[model samples]
Target chain A: MSGNILEVSGLTKTVGGGKKIVDGLSFDMKKGEILGLLGPNGAGKTTTIRMIVGLMSKTDGSVTINGRDLDEQGKACRANIGAIVENPTFYEYMSGYKNLKLWGRMAGGSVTEERISEVVSLVKLEDAIKDKVKKYSLGMKQRLGVAQAILHRPSLLILDEPTNGLDPKGIRELRDYLRELADEGISTLVSSHLLSEMQLMCDRVVIMEKGKVIDISDLSSLNAYGDKDQVAVSISVKKGQGEAAKTAVSVLEEVTVASHETENELLLDMGRDRIPELNRVLVKAGIDVFGIESKRTSLEEKFLQLTSGKADKEAN
Target chain B: MFALLHNEWSKLWNKKQPWIFIGILIVISIGTAFLYTAFDTLEGAGTEGDGENWEVTLELENEQYAQTIAESDDEWEREFAQDRIEENEALLAAGVDPNETNNAVFLNEMIYVGTAFITLFAVILASTIVSSEQDKGTLKHLFVRPYERWQFLVAKFITVILFAAVMLVTVTAVQYLMGTIMFGTGSFSTPVVEYGMGGVITTTVAEVFPQKIGLYFLNMLMFVVISFSISILFKSQTLAVGIGIFILFGTNILQGFAPLLQDYFWYPYVFLPHMTLQSYVVTDEFIPGVGLGFSLAVLAVYAVLFLGAATAFFQKRDLV
Candidate 1:
């Protein structure tokens, strides 16, 4: 069952100042899926989320949350959505517990004090929840913010830059908590410019740039390029014979070669499917081969390749 | 609505300014009464030096007493002189007249004048009632709730009204207490000024309680309407308060110098002039072209226009 909780089609917004902050953006999150919205700065991620939550009127297109039309039945539609926009502005003079309780009341029938307590525990803010929000550290405030969003048990949760200003440990904890939330069958859409964190946390990612969706892929697919088989061939020859092997491997059509003059080792980067052919070719070319191994790839390189590849393709 | 009322009541009661308003009312009412009574009592003292016309008449009577003592044959003149002296002494010894009390009038006047303080509080309290939430970026949280936008606007308006009522009641109570203590509780009544509205529309001061309450209610109502609109429009409490007070008092300041622009500016609604519960006490007959009712009607129209505008704009406003 493709249980899509939020389906936004052709969503666009032009602010009063005559700028198109959101342009033709469309995406969805399935039940039990955590979709990360990744983009660079000024990429309209916040604007898209705001439009989805009905905090903004779209200049064009429609957003349906849990199949309720946002414009025709705004309050009813928004009932199924919980969003933590920006800093999650709360009454600072109030305690975190009071703030959550008030938000719970605002969230209506689905929320209760017991649920508030549950959310606080979910965010690991049980100890500081009683303290005034103004006294909270940045990480604690963010955790409290998340607690407020989930207090109502909204079927769809949208968090804009949820892990911002958090330390690494806090970010990890937040990621773990979000995963646990998704495990309970809740749908989440988290936006961030940090691709690395997005790779680790999101079940899937919708890549946006310049107010438009450039790509949407599951985590496996987004990082698929990184995990592609690229066998690293490390070969050691007699001293002063490394250059000859590098020269010989350089002529191979299916492989790229690199050599360290002092180390007497040459590394051959070729696809696994092509590796056997290249090895046969290298043996035929009279290059001495010593060692061969594969190294783990990185999401950063994959993201760069995807974005840059798209840019190059567009240029063509 | 009940939850909204509870929140509003809590915020109002938690503040200190309401008590301060009561304190001002008590101090001014008592102080004015003591000063006015002292002035009246001192004025009743002897007709010494006999310079003014009334004092000259008393001096002339005293001279006649001296002449009768010199003649002495009838003693009737002497009796008359003794009677005159006793009458003047009695007049000098009498305290202020209880019937002609300006203390109540002055206390009521003080209440009218002190509305500026209330306006100041209204500005600060109601200005960012909604906008500040937007400014601090909290409005999204408010909007995502199940409540309709109109309910939020109504909640804010209700809160402002409650605060204003609390201030009015506390101040009036304190002033009433002070008036009783200092001016003596002999009578708490003003003589009914009978004025018929028309041939069949007969009304008196005693019968015009509705009109009086209506006028008080209207004055604060206008303040509420104006403050609510301006606060929503400006989105800054300080600016709303500053502008609201300015409009309330500034119009009066301009009206005071009406000789310069009275023709151009046809008397704007001065908040102080409309604050009195004694509408008849301060009524002015329309002189040829200028009508008091015309200005009041204009104010009434403005109040309606402000409320309509507030509802239209606030209801549609995106919380951001």
Candidate 2:
């Protein structure tokens, strides 16, 4: 209730007679926070989620949920967690309402009819709740999956690639619902390869590579790492002054010209405080400055750089 | 555990499989009764011209079997002739028509036919209980619940057993209705002769009918445990069912070969030799040294071993 809602330390999983699929991975999630697990193919994101949810056994280390150890007090720990590993599977032949009832009873709490109805509406599936799951669209199924997981209102919710087959609108709706859930104090751990979606959905992210935690940072702070004092700025100049503008920005002592958007516009890497200094320097050199704007690196770019082995250079 | 079992039961009841199986049993039950009635009517019509009473027919069959016993040099032939002669003598003295279509005969034949169908349905149920969840990828959902792995498994185990019981009761009820409507409840107190390992036994239809049904249920349990265990170990519904049905039918073939291998030390321990609980129910013995107690004990051991293995494997296995 006070500390982290979920904490995983030194978790390791080995398969095929000693092939370590997940090695020494550790992270934590605070209450009401949305944590994203990002990794490339075969980076063990699913394996880590599976181990945490007890779908797959861990070879070593421990998982503590709601201050209860998973190995020592599994039932107590698991009682606080609701998870859907990979694609959510359901009894497709049954109605979505029945599926919820089935899991609701198994969820080990007083799941009333009102609660089931509330969750059904929460996932926006009220119109289709009585329909067979086999008739549901992929996005509807994903929402139903979320409904099932949160039926008991567990302290921590884990979803592994919950948006695997969702369309754009469905993904947006899911992201919005997850944020709404987080605001209600349900800590969530989501594993997804969709960096853009993770950026929009997650509060903090743990980036993994080859079964190891490569990086963990706030979504806003990911671009701030290694460039804490510098900001990417783009300056627009008069139509034919692009070269002169680039030359003028290159000559500035505080700024490093990064690229040119056009013959008249130039991009620079400089401190936010020094942006005015460069603008003044360019204006004083008889340059026609149209506008200057600071640009931040996108999460997709940062993700590619980190996973492509440029993390060390970028972090430094 | 109760909640888990309740959930399992609900899921099973919600599916169309059990209902479909029930429908199949009903159709087969009514169909068998109608077919038997038709065949009985046809035979009675054809045999009326012979002018031979039921007693005269039995006497003639007994004389023929006695002559065969006297002339036959083969041991098995002599034994078969002697048993038939004794059966005829008993029927003749009891004034019971062997060809009569009565409620007792209906129930008895229904039990025999129903056991085969019930075994088939039970095998299908047990084999798919675990493996279908795995195949559908719904097992991970169950595993993530607060219940222990064995609780889910044991729930499924109990559900399959319950399903078999339900099927047995249903078949019996349908057969009873059909028999009452068609055969007028033909005196449940009437006597019937049953062949068993200890030779032959005579008992009232009321007593023997329930015992036969109970023995069939026990036989189903024996197969259910094995099939359920196979489902857990292999995680393949097809394999579990295939092997289950193979064992079900294969035991009959093995029974034929059993007499030849009766001298082997492991013959009694082999499951096929004891698959038929009818032998124990009738004569209280299946083989020379194997009695009711011994057969039930062996089956109990196999059941325990199967369930233990299923629990152990499911507990440790990763739900991939």
Candidate 3:
């Protein structure tokens, strides 16, 4: 058997007479890995998650979960998936414990009381589990949502914007829990517009734009310590020497001036081997360079660059 | 499937509306019993001769019905007076007090009032079952489970029926307790005379009461299906309930006009006039030329169509 838990290929969704909401999207999720579906607004991230969980119909393509085709073996395929699509909602009048029991029963099979308590404690909701959900804060409700999703120990747990309304501590707790679940070999697919959170939580990210996959990158590879062919270096010079430094860096043939960090700082994209040459050119132009450091591309920067580049290409 | 049904059952009992409805039913039923007891006592004190001699009361009531039957121009009025005369004569001969405050009589009255409220509550419950889940956005949690879409819909449909059954039993128990407490338990073997088109149909309270309850549920099933279909077709609980209640109360008005419309070929096929399943039990025919078999068959067809449409729509529509 392949180690992958979910394999989606050539997935397409068209709505309202041919407006393609999701177009030719394909990706795979491995066991014990957290795959982030990173996208801007209206990037079909939610649409893809909805289709994977079978909440929305896909116009074309096949979704196979743990080697079972979703179309032919839908019951078996969906049995392995637990999802919280968009925002998780429960019967507000019911206590959190009752809500969990209610959904646990709906999940089929006899869910023991121990399992219910286990999930409650796993989400750190033991104290608040007896309280009605209407009294729960957004963060507590989010924790309850995650607890319910993982109750059955589904092979693939899909969360769409699970951290949307969480406070910092709640987000951290969720991240820790997801990591712990991954340690036990449960795959998770989380979709989010929060790029930084995705950076901290996901192992690999599939970035999408305009109903299509733009890029897929390992989170470690996007970090500064990971291998990259080129790096953007930020040079800090004197406050008033910024304009002169820009002109000197622009005159260089190999390096591209990426952005100005501030009046005193200049950012440029070039190889590490040419940093000394660029420094010599800046010094020759009478610009005082105080400090030079290589800046790693953040997930946010990469996301903006990739999506904006696609938007530019489309416009062209 | 059992698990899903159990989950739905939990969701329903946890809500405030069902309990509130039960509370209201209990209050109204007990209050009505108290009022009936008080009125009967006062009327007995006011009429000295009639209270002592029911035979004299029956003779007077029979004479009045005979006068009405002779003077009435309307055919239905004459038939109604003639039936009342026969019913009163039978009660006089059997030594039964028509005005007695007994458990059987209270039960009969409660069922009459309870069935109306039960129908309203059943419609409200069925109309909101699916739509309320959609409104609260809990359907996503449910649909993601291993069950098929049709299974979810069927679970909800079965839950509504179970809810109706629960409500029926609750009403029966509450009314039974209150009736026994207020008025002594009357003889279940006592025969109550029902005025039929052919003549007086006599049956014991035990036999007739259950049949009325059965017919009540059957009538409720028709409304439940209609409201369930409306719930699936529309996401707004207000719209579903409003249309359901409108159809429910509107049918009374439609029945009034049914005689004029019965000449039309499609009159028997129309579901509203046929919803009066009680008419089949008490009278031979509610609508002219429409018997109990015909009404039941028409309602059965409507029930199937409503459920079929609901399941089909719910299966095909995207849960967005």
Candidate 4:
């Protein structure tokens, strides 16, 4: 049950003019894992997602979902996956309920009346389900989108930029729903440039840039990235003692000076267990430690450690 | 497959376009019935004898037509006189008077009228089905499901054909009822005039009804195939519908230019001139040499080509 749910190997999409919109890229998701494709706009995150879901053709590479090859067993492979690409669009003239029922019919009878009601309730769209989608708000549409994607009980769910237009509360609720789905052993591949939302939603993040995956880091627990078990500790000292603090902690083996925040402050990347030892060395150097705080592990910390590139892309 | 068709059918009726089209058809049908009544009365004006002595009047007209048929040197003029004489003889032999207004005559006149409108609506439906989904961004949802890309195309194609069939039948039904209500019920065995190989022909309304409807349906289907595939292959819905309308009305307009252009090798091969397939019910020859089978085969080949190109382009298109 814990094996890989989706494996995309060397997936590529070359558009007209012979330019590759999505270069050869590969990534995988374990069963029940929440994987995030983190990238700025124009990074080909959407293109890669489209190729996996069969919305677009791949110039090269293979995708296997639930042990079925996507190219060889397209229908069988799609049966196991549900998706929300960018904004969800339903028939504007139809009620939300009818829209779901239409999709239910397309799912080949796997979606029952009970299942429809259950999914509607899961997204808390019970009240608005009977209303036409043309009358729905953006937030309500997003909720219905989630309901539509998960209606068939697909083993794998893919959402591209699910947080594009959601409010803070709506995004939090979506995060909660996704985590709840993960608890039920359903895997999700969510793509977004909203690093902070991905921070709270995904169990792992695959950072992409310019149609290529640059890094894949585990974010389920604190700091499972470069230098395992390490944390970013910022030690603020007396104005003149910053240099002395630096010289004093130079003797430590596992600690690296991460970055300097101010003239009187220094940031250190060291093992969590070595925090006290490094603090003692600074005090032993006749430096008064004014504020010594260990920062919580986050994607922000990883972005700083991995690359100096822009971390958060606020794309629409 | 049932589910897919049901979904398509629901989508078509759920929108406002079909309702508006139906409403307009009803209004126009009623208007045409009244217009025809007015014209019928105007032509038979000012004389009670004109209404009562139609048999003597037709005999006199037939004698003149017979003289033209025997004396006219022009081949088309001779054919025209021959057509008129035979048409009057059929009515006289059937003992049906032309001055008598009846539902059968109304139906016989209007049966093929609504097909132009039906083809218009079908073209609109077929042109918009796929492209509208793409415009709304829901096409990717359709493609990502557990169905092949061509299944959606096939479903849409079938849906358009069904729509055309329904419209054709519905419009005819409405016309028949209006005719019955406006005029007196007439015999189905009333002689209907038609043009055939080298001469005019006459058959009963009951005999020609099915042939006219069936041939027109086949013609409209070819229209749907061309427009549906164009919309799928191209991104612009307007261009597809435009081409469809051009093919619809252009068939008649281009015929005025046919004599000047008929010498070209490509003229007979052009499917536009052959689109009026219902004419085949009256005559085997479309032009000098083209027959019903050859025209049908040409239309089928064009349909396959348009649909093939559309499916190929659609299957590979990146919906992003």
Candidate 5:
């Protein structure tokens, strides 16, 4: 009765030559929480979700659902979860409704006729619900994927890249549906490489880099996280005074010269507030300041810097 | 387990392949009956007694067969004549009409023939039943449910066995209908002729067919088990199906090699020779003392081994 619907601790997966593709991932989801797993490609989000849902075996560590250990009570543990691993594929020869009934039957036969129609129309699939899945477009298939994941009203919903191949409207509708489900006290774990989407959909986000959780943070300062940790504020004094600019900024306590981008421009690794401090030193040194320009504020660039480790250390 | 079985059964009937398989079976059953009727008059005229004087006609055919056996030097032709002569003498001694072809006779003969098609379709069905789910990317969805991996597999195994049984029942029913339409229904107790190690044997359809169909059904169950195991264990669907069909037809080819290989100590243990367990009904022994019990035992051992490997592999396999 921890009230955490899903708990994963030190979960690891190793491939050939003992390479840990997913290493030491520990996270927990509370009741009615919308937790997003945010990582770049190859961050092991799918691998972790697969292990939690029993699609793949874990080489080490444990996953517990609804206070039930996965090893001791796997069926009971899985009964609490509904997942769409990677992309959802259905029995294409069957109608969408029949496919739902098939999945509903597999969930210990508790899904009712009313629940079937409720999920169908909840996903707005009532129009083509009787048609074969083969005829449904990618967007329709995505919607049906949502329908099947919620058919049994599982307490834990795991969707790996559920927004893949979805339009903007579809994505928005899915976000709204997830919020509605969250209002009903069903915890959901959604993984995506898209940071903005995660920011919009998740109540909390766990950022991963290189098969490990680099940082866990709320939505407010995540944009700030990208900026502060990046190699920002590349300064260009006089063409000849680049050397002097480096010499003058050496007086500062926490400055490190990041890179020598050009003969005249010295890329400085320091916080944004210290830009004026270095400017004062350069002016005192009697060097003509050509210009002090920080790198452009693109989130993806900052994210790359974040995953590449510079932003992480700054945040820590 | 029942819920899993219901899910699998629903998914199976939702496809088109099983329906097409049963459709072809009905057409073949009806078509073969009409084809047999086209040559019925020729066969009646050859005996010179039609259907009513079947006992007298057997005597005339036996006299003609004796002359043919004496004049023929080719081994097959001589054996054929000698065999028919023994069959006629056995039927006459038993007072059973040899020329009575009716619903019971048609059913007895055609049930095994239709099951050959059943065996083929069942092998194909079992081969693709699991691997097709893998190919279609729906397998991972099943893995996430509130059931063990082995439960899904066992459900599929039972489904295929059920499918093969349903095909057998349906094919027999359709063949019986066609038989009644063409030749009329005869006594289920009508005597039929069979060749055995001790010469021709006389038995009734009622006395013989239960054993035949029962043995056939058991043998067909082994076929389904083998193919279903191979389907789950192997990665490639086409290769799984190819090996399944190869094993199905390969049993007959192995029958040709049985006599040569019988001297080997391991020959009896190999499952191929035992695949035709129905053959043991007429002959008391396949060779000297090997019989239905030995074949059944060998098949049971093999079925356990095949399914053991499949279940072990399926339980540990990580669906990527």
Candidate 6:
């Protein structure tokens, strides 16, 4: 990652009734990076994003986007950003093209008709662009939201659950589209509670719990805790072979073996360097070895461990 | 700013609400024309004798009293005086006579009444222009755009004024055509201004031209500012419209008796003598020696203050 494109420090928002929804939250997103904000309900992710976009005022703290203070130069700062704060409300009575055209004007660029048509095609809404937005399906609306956010080619894009209501196919399309955007050097921040999807899309993830940032880590770092560094070797053996397998496993130092009577087998977890030693020990012990395999940790296991395990519970 | 203006302009022209308002105005025009036409035909030859006509009853009472004064017998004189007193009482019970004297006067009165109805549309239209976005949650989408808050508000304000102007002209045109065809294209009977002995002055009904333009434009502007201020204050279209209509009507009624509060400390500021555009139209008293110029200046100040507050509040508001 390059230098940070968006930095929020000590952000707090105490709503009207004296409740602090977001307190002391801080995070940094680097250039051309895709950061996912993962949180449960009432975790203050939306509130923090609103404040950053200048839609909701911060109770105390600062937000800088592309090195410009959000408060000091709000217009200048927001000019470089585009956000889809929630479900992306649009003028429902207006046609899709008209809605984008109106917002594209407000986005303030050299937004030509050609550029608008290009965006329409980019979102894959070319056939339906002339239809009123009220008639659009939820998936279509989601795409339209993406189209509007990226219309001006803003450097920093913020989406709150951009795929909140999409089906399987739409979600995959959105994933690819977001990846393409990041590849084009646009920094994006996407918020979602879909952990697996986030793991797949984000270069890094920031998980919040109860109004604070609980963890911020790259995908590799999150994997470190749950990854499998040992290789497994399964060997077929004769009936009444438990004692023999145990003796055989004992020969390979630092190998842990467990026997299953029903299958008449031994399962071994050993380091890559010890695989040959285990084979020699098994052969010396006169046990027939079937196969050896290595399995890496899946993202689902890493996500659950990172989000639900004691490491985060204790940190929070 | 220009882009915001263009967006607002398109919303105003293409929305269903403005067309609905225009449709309402059309219905009102047709209704007013029918009501006035029926009244004119019934009072055929301008005899002013229809029992339903309140102004006619007052005129008859005055004539009866003149005849009663010419009698000589004491009992007869007393009896005639009692008859005259009874007639006067009957006339008063019919309520204040609306000034529908002739076709010209009636048309002018219709314009005044139409102004009130049109004010409702202006207030609601302007308030909704800003507050509806907030209510519908569309404002968040708008706020995240590059446009400044003040520019957005100004564009909304301009759209409201243009909407109000179109409604005003449509109603005025319909009334003008009906009034001309029915009233024989007569020159205005009342003078623009009248001067009594020793430079004492009296206003009349004839000066409705430029003064009508002034009153309608000024009142429209005032209503726009008022609606916009309330819209920003409440951030709700329904409340803004309701409160605006109540204040518009309430202030007029209160100002009718405002001269009674001349001894109070707050009379000058509460002096809302502006509903009677005819008083301004006829007497040149709207500004007295200074004329319409002074009246316009005072109105401008109110407009600026309210619109400025709207700008300030909108800019500072958290887009919920």
Higher-ranked by TM-score: 2 or 5:
2
- Chain A TM-score per candidate? 0.80, 0.89, 0.85, 0.88, 0.74, 0.79
After superposition, candidate 1 runs with Cα above 4 Å error: A16-19, A222-299, A309-316, B4-109, B180-187, B190-214, B257-281, B284-297, B315-320
Docking class of 3: medium
Could you tell me how far off, in angstroms, the CA of residue B212 lies in candidate 2 after the best superposition? 0.9
lDDT of each: 0.67, 0.85, 0.84, 0.85, 0.85, 0.74
Candidate 1 displacement at residue A114 in angstroms: 2.0
For each candidate, report what fraction of the true interface contacts it reproduces. Answer: 0.62, 0.76, 0.88, 0.86, 0.95, 0.69
Query: In candidate 1, what are the lDDT values of residues B1-320, reduced to their tens digit?
Result: 55555544553454455556556645654565566557645654543333235444555656777777778877786777676565543333342121234334334434554445555566556665666666777767777776676677788778877777766666556655666666544333443222222111222323443355446666667766787788777667667777777766765675456555544444444433343323433344322354456556766777778777877776666545
How big an interface RMSD has model 4? Answer: 0.8
Per-residue lDDT of model 1, residues A4-82, tens digit only: 7888889988877978888888887788889988877777888888778776668888887787778888888777777
Provide the lDDT at B131 for model 4: 93
Which segments of model 3 are wrong by more than 4 Å?
A: A227-229, A240-263, A272-290, A309-316, B42-47, B50-52, B63-87, B93-95, B196-200
Looking at model 5, residue A15 earns an lDDT score of: 85
**lDDT by residue for model 5 over A1-316, one digit each (tens)?**
7989888899999988999989999988889999998887778888888889888899999988999999899999888888899889999999999999999988776899999999999999999999999999888998899999999999999999989888999899889989999999989999998867887788888888768987676654444445355436777766777787788888997888878766688887677667777888889999888888866334444465668855334332
Candidate 6 C-alpha lDDT tens digits along A1-316: 2378999899999987988899899999999999988876677888888888888889998899888889898888788787888787878888889899898888765678888898889889999999999999999988999898889888999998887778989989989888899999999999887777787788898888777887786875444433335555566666666577677688666777744545567666666566667667767888765654543344444545655764333422
Candidate 6 error regions (>4 Å): A15-20, A220-316, B45-65, B68-107, B180-206, B256-260, B271-279, B282-309
Tens digit of per-residue lDDT, candidate 2, span A151-171: 998889999998888999999
Candidates ranked by DockQ: 3, 4, 2, 5, 6, 1
Worst 10 residues of 6 chain B by lDDT: B191-200
